[model samples]
Target: MRSECPVRAVASGSGGRRSYLVTGYEEARLALGDARLSKDTAAFFAGVDSKRRLHPAVAHTMLAGDPPRHTRLRKLVTGAFTSGAVAGLRPFITRLTDELLDRWPADGPVDLVADLAVPLPVMVICELLGVPETDRPQVQRWSAELFAAGEPGRTDAASYAVAEYMTGLIASKRLRPGDSLLDRLIAARDGEDHLDEDELVSLAVLLLVAGHETTTHFLGNAALALLRHPAAMERLRSAPDSLPQALDELLRFDAPVSTSTFRFTTEAITLGGTEIPAGVPVLVALGAANRDPRRFPAPDRLDLDRDATGHLSFGHGIHRCVGAPLAKAEAHIALRAILTRFPRIRLAVPDERLVWRHTRLVRGLDSLPVLT
Candidate 1:
């Protein structure tokens, strides 16, 4: 796979265990979509010393759920992010993008990550969760540390802080409810669908982190691809309809989550001729599968014109990202606006100097310095 993508796996695993990394497209789909694999992270979750700091519950989102529970959690929020629902948010999203652009520097380079990518989604998510705007920065910080490596105690502290904050918010919502998603959720009943406080807090945190972090990475990545490939960016700038197609390719070529939230093996399964023992954890390489040559010719090269919709940036089947439509809308607005406003946008720093978060599950640069 390395010959095809950035990371390669030999048909081997440690301890001469005859382990093999499934790199092909068919194998990936079979592994992820099949019922034999589990989404529970309990195997590793228990073994890992919380030496790195993560709120136990915060680590488990819809990403870590399966079956009836997964259905419940996802159903409560999916309606808010469907095509029609996300379309409803367009006016607000456009206004937000415009406001950010208006404040952007007119001449020199600016870090798009800070100026646009970070706040746009963060604000949208805050609104969705009914989180106070003033609390967003703090929420964003906590979300970052929960997943970020390199710091130990800090990640734990941040996790606890977020948990505490959510706990307070949930308590408040229980009393004085408002006309927001959170309020509706607190009042939700699907044959008595009310969530326990713990469940409610868990969903709130999931949406907060997933809603912003993943979409922000998409914006940053799409921008990076355009900046690197001038012609693709220009084509998008010239043809408005091309934006959607280009976004598809960008998603395929540079998936945000390098791997899906971890999945465990339920029963012994043979993948790539290796038997993954039941209860073992396996990471889905979405990025690697996105570039599988057997599935996409010239897979590594970004082609805005290609049919790129089948990419697994969103996991397949029932586990597909619930917020996909909302995310796509944001990406279109963000990228189109960036291209139109700054047709001459280009990387301000040398490509080699750009740094990526080595510990992140999602793939994105720390700063996207661009001349606007």
Candidate 2:
């Protein structure tokens, strides 16, 4: 689309809503940080359709709010994901990665998505949130349904299930709290400036889901990328220190989030010489922007040595993913562990036979079969 028009309006859909898609790298970057484009879905939809309402647990999150609300909610959880905090969890992540890998069979094909990628992040996030091991299986199921595309009924059910689960969990933590992040958040509620029940539940659900989903897909995508590019895999295996840089290149090559969440235009804005009307929705194509030739030389080629500093994988601006540091830490540890454990691991099936999940919000494999 960049070749034609970076910012182009899509024909009105069934709802007769006009939306804009930003495909160019520069346009997407600018649009992502632009305050003129608001993330307050409630306010945007209030006048558009009064009867339509989202679940409180889904609506009142930092992801769906703008400015003041976003600022406050983000402040409460920001400290937990800071570099120092993530650094402290490195030992735990490394140990967890080893433990998960150890359970894999000594000789056979294994689904990396199910065996490693999914569980690693799920367990890490669950531990951080203080979810008991007994409840993790159910939590994982609900989270999976929440992200399933084209299934409104299942999505709504999952949302309600998660809200109920978190609400109960929060109540439990109130009586006997621990040092986990959830406990600290509960403590925050007792303070002078505090989170309400809805906000607290919403934030918890957001963390539980977002904390793991991105990294889950990222690991799968990164593994597939390495398998396809033998030289890149060899480079990382030969020099373990290069894994970090290679990860960035891998993310840019195949972003986990194909498109960003909705951002509505607060006022008429021009992007890439195209003026979009106010109140219209805008979708930034993160995957496309990352591969824009104008921004990166030989954009499609996986160059681990190249500096992929501006990739929009985790997004840009204030709403950029807060879990990025932890995700990277987990991915780095997990990827390194996988490589070290199975030096000759390769795809069990042909590349074309692999199936991707049918979700628009997340880009991931349904299963990554590989021989160890």
Candidate 3:
């Protein structure tokens, strides 16, 4: 796409609705941070008729709103995921990783996605949110279904299910308050500013879903990347201290999110010499941008020493992922633990046999069978 034109318009949907796809690194960076691109889906589709309507709690999330609302909502939960706050959870994450790994069988292949990558982040996020351990399995199921592409009915059902679950959970938190982040968010106040019933439910759902999904895929992707690159894996195994620095390159090499969430232009904007008109939807290909040769030398080759700082894996600008610190902390602990525990871990199946999840937003494996 970049070879032809970095930004180009394409037939995105029925009824002649044209959308833009930004694939170049510089163009994607600019499009992500540009205020001209609005995230307000409600306003965009105000009068459009549709067969299904999203629940208010699902539709009004910070991810779907532009600034002012986005700023207010993000501020309430930002403190819990800051670098210092995440650092405080290192001991907990390390302990949890050890516990999960300890359960692996002594002599057989295990699915890393199910055994480690999926549950590790789910448990961590659930603990942080104070979700009852008993309810986590259902929550995980709903979260997974919400991302099942090409299954609109299932996705819609999952969205409603999770939103209702969060609503009930919030109500429960009010009766028995705890020190978890959810408790703090429920009691949070900025003068007269407070989250209403809908906002509260929406925020909780967002945190629970987004908090773990990206990291889950990231671990799978990182593990696969390491398995493919023996030298990089060996270096990390030899010098555990360098894992943190190498994580960026890992993220760059195979991003967890293939493309960013939808952002439509409020007005016409030019990107990479292409003019995108007002109200046109733009999809920034994060995976494609990360591999743009102009930005990263030998972009396809995984080089741990390469400076991968500007990668758009977590996104850019005001809407950059707030959970990045926590995600990084979890990855560092989980990867280090896996490498240390299973020195001889290798993929059980051939490279061509591994199956990827069928989803547009998330890039992850269906299962990663490995011999440990």
Cα shift from native, residue 213, model 3 (Å): 0.7
Give the better candidate number (1 or 3) by lDDT. 3
Q: Extract clashing residue pairs from model 3.
A: none
User: Which runs in model 2 stand beyond 4 Å of their true positions?
Assistant: 47-54
- TM-scores vs. true structure, each candidate: 0.92, 0.97, 0.98
lDDT of 2 at 258: 94
What TM-score would you give candidate 1 relative to the actual structure?
0.92
Better of 1 and 2 by TM-score: 2
Question: Please, what are the lDDT tens digits per residue for candidate 1 over residues 235-326?
Answer: 88889777977787899899988877767677777776556777666667788888888789999898977898888888788888888888
- Judge candidate 3 against the unseen true structure and give its global Cα lDDT, from 0 to 1: 0.91
RMSD of each: 2.9, 1.4, 1.2
Query: On residues 40-142, what C-alpha lDDT tens digit does candidate 3 reach at each position?
Result: 9889888988766557777668899998999998999999999999988999899989998998987758999999999999989999999999999899999
Candidate 2, overall lDDT? 0.90
The whole-model lDDT of each prediction reads 0.79, 0.90, 0.91
Error of 1 at 28 (Å): 1.2
